[model samples]
Target: MTPWTTLLVPDILRRICEYQRGIYEDVVPFRRFLSNGATVHGTSKQAQAFESVLSPWLALYPSISRLVASYEPIKHALACHCAYTGRAGILQHLHKRYILQSVAVNLCQMAIAGQRLDVLEYLVCIGYELPRQFESVYLSWKDQAVFDFVFEHYRPLCTTNTTIYAFASSGNEDALMRLLSYVDEAQIRLMWSVAASHGHVELARTIYTASVDISDHVYQFAGSSFFSTTFQHIKNAANVGSIDGMFWIYDIANPFFSQEDRIAVVGFCLKYAVMENLWDRVWTLLEQADGRVDYPQLLACLPYFKWPQDESNARSMLSSTPALIPMFCTSWLPTIKDQAKRRLLEEELMSMAVLYHDGDRLEAREWLGDVDEYYFNAMEWLMDEYCIDKSIAHDVFQGPLGVAAMKRAIENDHIATMRLLLKYGVQIVPEYIFRRGGIRAIKFYLDKVNPEFTIPVDLLVEMASTPTNDTVFQIVHRTWRARTSITIVHTVESQCIAQAEAHGQVNIIIYLAKSFQSVHSPSEYETFLIQHVQDFYCAFNRARHGVNQLFAIWNPVLDACFNVEFILESLDSLLALTEENLKRLVSLSFVHIPTELIVQCALTNSVLAWRVFCILLDAKIKDKSSRMELQRECLVKKYEGRKFRNVPTVDGLGF
Candidate 1:
């Protein structure tokens, strides 16, 4: 029996309808009244907003025919999806079936989003009213073809600067130039400000070239208390890190401002560029200022450039501008409110300098204001010629500061430096060191330390799960095997797998799953498999519910399990591929599941099976793999002799 013919079976249809109703219970409250296929006028505003938000999700509906039979308010929503995905046949079916009204506005926008001119032309032919809010449409349209089509067909009324501003914000220079012909030359200030603020450098340049200067033109800055008579747009461009636009404005307005005003402008650019971490712009502004900027005030903005996140740029600042570190130490460090964080940043700065250049540089030594700071700086550079003298080594290694410096060395994976620290009797908590350090440091520590101080198994698991510590994790596994007395406890193993999956550590998941199976009987391992899968699902569902959809899409468990044969085998054994579960898997937005597996598990007791079948078909189409095609042929051969009815034929597989 064909798959689509099987969908026509009454029992299958009823089962699918029940499943869809259960899955979409949250969408029921958003329904609008439909009278003779036309939308009624008096729905609540909240319902309308819900409809807009649910439109994209509804397009992912498994059964379009079932959707038409049961849900009425969402038919137009499906229309929007059809336009977005460029499914002309589905769109034509929806239009002929519903006579969808009050839809031209969204259809036009959807066509623009999808970059579908054919859909737009179809809408225009159907006599739907042209959209009146051209600014919204123009603001979103990026394709030149769609822009020209709308421009030529609709001929937007440029009665307000809002239209010009939206067009400029889209960064379509050709379209903006065409739009400027309709706008008055005197009212281009708003357009220019929007362009510059949004980093549309070319659009801002084009607008500035065509604008007429008014003697009394006082450009009012929105959402700010100040107004400017000259070069306000230049500052706006700088605020958004628009380097090209800033230079263009500087070239035109340089002669108009006084010396102090010029310094102020460059200083403003330097401050924001540092905060935005625009290193190239920062260097350009510093060079252009020609040593006129107040170094102390500039150093105060360093905190805004986030540490570790922008550590590379901070290092670049140190290398390119030699005066930055010196000024930061003398002027900025004293004013920082959090002295502890300030000291850490100070240590990292010195270590970074030592990383890039010789640690004996005078400027690096000068930044070490205190005795402890000197010890920390020397630890990173203490090799061969830069070795510390024996006289003070004992006192330096015995203090708590030395312990902190040791931890830093371990975290940085500085094996030679770590050996030096250990040589001088620097104290370390073995468990803490093992958790953070990589393989080389861990192996060195294990080899040097007494055997009785072997790291605990729990710490081993924690080490294995730490993000970006894969090499250390491998050594951890080997360490476990080396100590034959340590038994793998069930709870500890589960925790290791869960955390590794959460962090997306693929290697750890495979190692643990396969290793556990190897050590236990099939029956015992089956129970373990069931519990592990349950824990993963519970954790995954909790994460999906608590966080935004974008966050859930990157949930590490998905990547951790991707292409792992053990996980696929576990999922297959559990028969866990139901419609709801399939949807959850698809939302990962990555790989496609096996088609044969979906046929085996997703269609169980699903009388109206086409919806679930369609999802599998969609996944297969996207898979684009000849292996998946072979699997489909296998599935067809397996089910070909069954007496299913009314199922739709798949795209590639003939019924």
Candidate 2:
């Protein structure tokens, strides 16, 4: 091989020499050029020179092999690169040049860290070994395969406390089991604190059970303070709502917690249970505390309760601590910022007073002295429970309170209370009656209370627009009966017809259309039909009943419009209309009817076509006009083209 100096020109040599001066200044770029130089034209002398310059840079770039491989001394950099990149082939090349004990040790650590099984096997094949403490790195990496390989092939390394800590902290039970064969009791006990910190509950329990003296170990591990000790493990379980872990710690380990600490634990557990609305667990923990937790402590944690709107939870909490009611009635109720929560609390207190205290008139009176403020709220609850006395009912029905209370009663279907309020001279609010009370209540009030009262026309329209039952139609019919003005009656009638038709109410539509036609003027009826033609057709199409019923509802509008296109489009109506009605329609609107539509209808139903031919013949007989004759001829030719034979003619028609 040519010497490196002969391979390079003088300018390149000058660049290499300059590179040597600043080799330390810019190691990365210079090392890149040196690797290129060596690969292209390298000799033993240049390789030796490059080795001296590139040694310090190896620590900065362990993964870059070209920079490190340009040097021969410290060929371990090559092994390091091989191990780092999981390239075992390069390790074999370096092995031929030098014995790499340090490299082998580093390779084992890297294999464990990178989870490279091939590198580990290569090291073992080369008779390279690892120290005992290197197991800590393996344990920390939590790679069970590598740990097992190292443990089985290598002589058992003495397990250290740190290794045990890493095993427990990682929550790897299998690794800890392997270590347990060599670890002492004291070292295993030290593992508990870390296990607890990492929420390794099962591992901690295993440690406790395996101990020769668990109580001493648990006491030592739990230490003196509640906040800082391993007792936090139990508290952490409680915070996460881990019931099983908390029970495990309490039952198995039974650490020596101070009385204050015990109470703190109970409080934490209760707070979590209440926040989660786990009433069963809350009661369990409360009973376990055995009355150690006071009312004030629970009240301080009231914000944690999730269901402030639930009456059952309020009752449960109040029933748990009855003594708190007096304070809740007087102090807490007024101080609570959430009115909804305060109202629920008051309702529960009132119910309890009624159930437990024999109606406790004085306490009830004090609680309800602000009656006007909470009158509706109190009345609603009392009326629902059937516990309101006549005097309370009478007192609550004074002035506008009676109006408001009656409205609520009507909304809640409290007919008895409604009668009670009315008997006590509570006047009804007409709008409220219209809004809350349906037709039944309205009729009852109109017939029984005041016959002179009139529901607003807008209110009637609004109610008609809304979806209603059959009773609304009855109410509207009754209102039409009672009203005197024809215009208002027709307007209500027309709007109600449109609204009812929109909802596909066939019975209501029939009744309204019949009623409308009975009192309807020609112009008014025509205008109504014209305005609602689209809506009427839509209703007819979407009608749920049979063809006969829809015909009854839609016949009048069809006859008045006499629109041939519409009748042809509605195939159901075309087939269902009687021959007499079809004849009358054709006779009245023959000029407006198209020949194609007539042809289609005749092709569909030939008997109807014969009737139309008779009508056209009757028209031609009466007039004998050329246009009528031409129309007759065209329709006759179209019908005859179908080859429909044996058609009967109307006997009454003279052609």
Candidate 3:
């Protein structure tokens, strides 16, 4: 499916360009009706504008039956907008729909491809209500085995699922049952499992079946987090009074056995159930176990056995009451590989819930923080060697309250730790991290410590000069090979310009802007600047909600400088200032440029990209001759290394 990005609304402008009619006048009249939020996005404007151009496409009542036979354009549009996240959302939303339609189909296709549920639901509603005859051939639900039969021909009349993954994970019985008619069986199973694990108790109960297999495949796919939660839900069921669920668990889960894992499973089940005063049931289960149990099992059972006797019955069970011990029985705590040993240990640990210093790792984990390395070690050992898979470790490591790992790395100032995490796919600056913390740690690491991880200088210069009158301009202007990740957090381009402008770093500014232009069309940059006219102008609405005062301090080269005095004499003619100006920016790099001046040139544009980006990529600068050749193409001037200042220095002097 083509993205809405395909027919860049800019194309409409192009279409208008070929006409001699009063197009701008017509658009200008309705401009007052556009969005009031901000001009840069023009999101509201685009919506209004689209209604006129696209309304005719939606004139018919039927929507899905008219989706474009080809989806290339919508697909292309979204890709252009950097809307990959949107596409994934859409696919999960309307994947069940089938119709040889045009307008509504295009919207649905885009909605599904972009994973846009809101748009998808809206389109689907339109498709279903404004009824149309869907080509019967296209309405084949037979091939779409995932969804229920009704959804094959049309979307459901109502959309209770607001989130992309919401209905997919609804624990509500009615919702799940209703949703089954719309989505695939596998999807329904996943939704049920995910919802159940998330503590949607009623929903989980509604979905769980006596015959359903506890799938190892599902466990592996959902990861330990899901299973851990599922286990927690099972433990909580009896406490909550779900009779059907409790009986179902008892009937399905043979938590005890005589020959094998009986004690561990039975003890765990009893812990939750007995806590609620189900004494008779407990005694019945214990009697059922009979001769299969041992002294420890008997002791564990005695707690509830005497629940009829007194609360001390639980205490008696916990102490192992020396009187209950056989003459030959060992009194000391035991550890072993078999379930018998584990069952005894689990009882001991549970016993410690009221006592202390059991020397049992699980007990210690509950009572203390991670201050003890010994406990952590025991935990690691239990997890790695005991569990068939290392899933248990993942379970113990959640709740994420303290980022001990990140904190430890910061304290040690360990570059290796950072690399290791990167290798393990831990993001130091995850998007959420930046949103909450706002690069404080990153800034500290970059500015204070001379950590071994540094980015390239040209990128900095490009960013520095891009935003005029920026604080900490000196940091950006330095022509260094290594820099920390702090500077690249935002506005690498603008920062380069800010840095260059702060230090009169023209060469850097030119290179950086130009580099930004090459891969993306130059017109895009121009459009962005025009769109952001107000953001660049705080005091004056350059376009609206402009950024700073400087962009408006025009060199008279621009036809309409926003609020600042126009340097009419100094300004280059507006025509001469085309998208070609974008060729002056530079990208971030790690490689060291030989001459600081050469480095400066690299920051200006694609012309200098040869030296800096290549160096950044390969970790080595290009040969002097090749660099000089690139310098010539980018600068549009001859290079005699020393002609300007010095052969090696980018600065005006002969460093």
Candidate 4:
């Protein structure tokens, strides 16, 4: 036979055994599979190759068995597997070798946990001492057969109270009854406490029945304060939807609770009843309390209640208390989205207000402050439904009330409400409307409310500068059209043109430029156009120096000047300028053009480049000199060399 060294050295085998032992400790199912039959089939390719390498080594090195037997992890795993799988043969072999001593108690626990009576008996026959808390483990199992066997064979390891409490808490009726033969009244009361606290209603009832005096235990359980085991049990019962358990403690067990406890109990029941939509139960509890409970305290609890499934019952419960109308209006009405339900709530509120105020509008209006949103809703409701006089409705919208209502209406974009307030002689500032009412509301005011209203020039300029909507520009245009005096047109035209140029509104700039040209002479038009181009160039350069280079590119006035047709026409108007003014315009226009773009154009299209160069040359001729002509010739020759070099060669022949 081949020696184990041929397969692997002893050190390598020892390391492999150590790794397997570590795995055996943490992985129970894998340990069970190893003990059953350490077989590997249809595994991954890597696992198959690993097995092919390790199997021969493991077989040859039977010293691994002695190592495993002595190893703590392997001993534990074997004990657990034998106890769990009822493999007494393995347990007997391990015990004969004294390898099961380390895991004897754990093996007993596993046997009890798995209810393996045969393994337990074998473990006992092998002189395995049971743990002191073995009965605790036995009670947890709640298997009567195992408990009986453990009780008859093993000495009592746990007290009767611990046993009874465990049985009661586990809701094991048969095991609890079997243990009941040994429990006295105190233990029974303890069992009742545990059973009730754990939501074991039937077991609790049985224990309570077996107790001598239920009231003593109940009082002892409740202690001196409301935050006691009794209260906790009741609340837990309610939370778990165990109505019988909750009522058994509240009604049957302790009927004569204190006034505070009664109020608390009724409040809890009422809250649950309302949440569950138990209308009859809610009314019954309320009547039984008979005004003993604080209604506001009860009403405060209503918000914690869920929206009931049957909303009609919820409405009935709410309407049953007329004094809570304000609470409902302020607290609950806003959350309701259904129009019909809201209308129903409003009708209830209106009826309650009428009944309480005895048809006195001033009294009800005083009861509901004018600044409150609910008051406005009530006033609107009264005017619409009760046919209250418009003069009376108008009375509420005076002073602070009027301003508050108008502000809210504007904020909510309620145009109809604003119109209503205005009809009632409520004066509003146009500036306030412009500031808060946005462009639509501003337009509404201009077109419908007051056409003569004028926004300040500074504000109009600001609005034009960052015009979120084009309609603002249209509104400013309308204002300009309405008053076309020379000064007004010039001011409006200059502001609009500056803003349009700043925002890269080329189309708007073109339109304004045409308008300005139509109203002014050619010289005035040329002067204003140059001023606009200069302003745009200054703003663009300032933006380029800041973090707004992208804005600079988008708002480049040179691009606008080239793209806008009306701008070209305006530039044509400048064709008859003085020599100095032409030079200035040509310099300003070329200053903003990127040099790289000019070079690319000069190389790719020499004709266009020459045309631009000739234009510049003509503009510079006011102080014509030989130096200027020589410099222009040098620039032309430089571009010509670049253009010729860019031409492709076809078969060594330039194309």
Worst 10 residues of 1 by lDDT: 35-44
Runs of candidate 2 with Cα error greater than 4 angstroms are 1-26, 29-77, 102-105, 124-142, 153-173, 184-229, 235-241, 250-254, 275-655
lDDT-sorted candidate list, best first:
1, 2, 4, 3
In model 4, where do residues sit more than 4 Å from their true spots? Answer: 1-65, 68-77, 99-105, 125-129, 132-142, 151-171, 181-203, 213-219, 222-232, 235-240, 252-267, 275-655
Candidate 1 stretches greater than 4 Å from native: 1-11, 14-71, 102-105, 133-140, 157-171, 184-187, 190-203, 213-244, 247-266, 270-655
Clash number for each model? 14, 0, 90, 0
Better of 1 and 3 by lDDT: 1
User: Model 3 segments beyond 4 Å from truth?
Assistant: 1-75, 78-171, 175-247, 255-267, 281-312, 315-655
Residue 339 shift from truth in candidate 1, angstroms: 33
- lDDT by residue for model 3 (1-655), tens: 1224322343453344345224433442233323233232243234435554443323322221122222223322222121212433333223334322421223333333333444445445545332333222222222232123234434442222332135433344544566555554345445554454455646655554411433322222233343344344345444554533543444433432222444444445554445556655555555454313344544444344322243344433334322232211222222234666554443333222212234442221222222222323333333344442333233322223123444444333344433333333344542222222223344444554434544455534444534332322333333232343445533555654454545444444444444444535656666544543332322222122111223323212133333322211111211122223311111113212234444443444443434333433223334666645554453433243436443443222111
Q: Best by TM-score, which number?
A: 4
For residue 242, model 3's alpha carbon misses the true position, in angstroms, by 6.9
Candidate with better TM-score, 1 vs 4: 4
Ranking by TM-score: 4, 2, 1, 3
| Residue 180, model 2: Cα distance from true site in angstroms | 3.5
Judged by lDDT against the true structure, how good is candidate 1?
0.55
Best lDDT among the predictions, by candidate number: 1
**Candidate 3, residue 364: lDDT:** 19
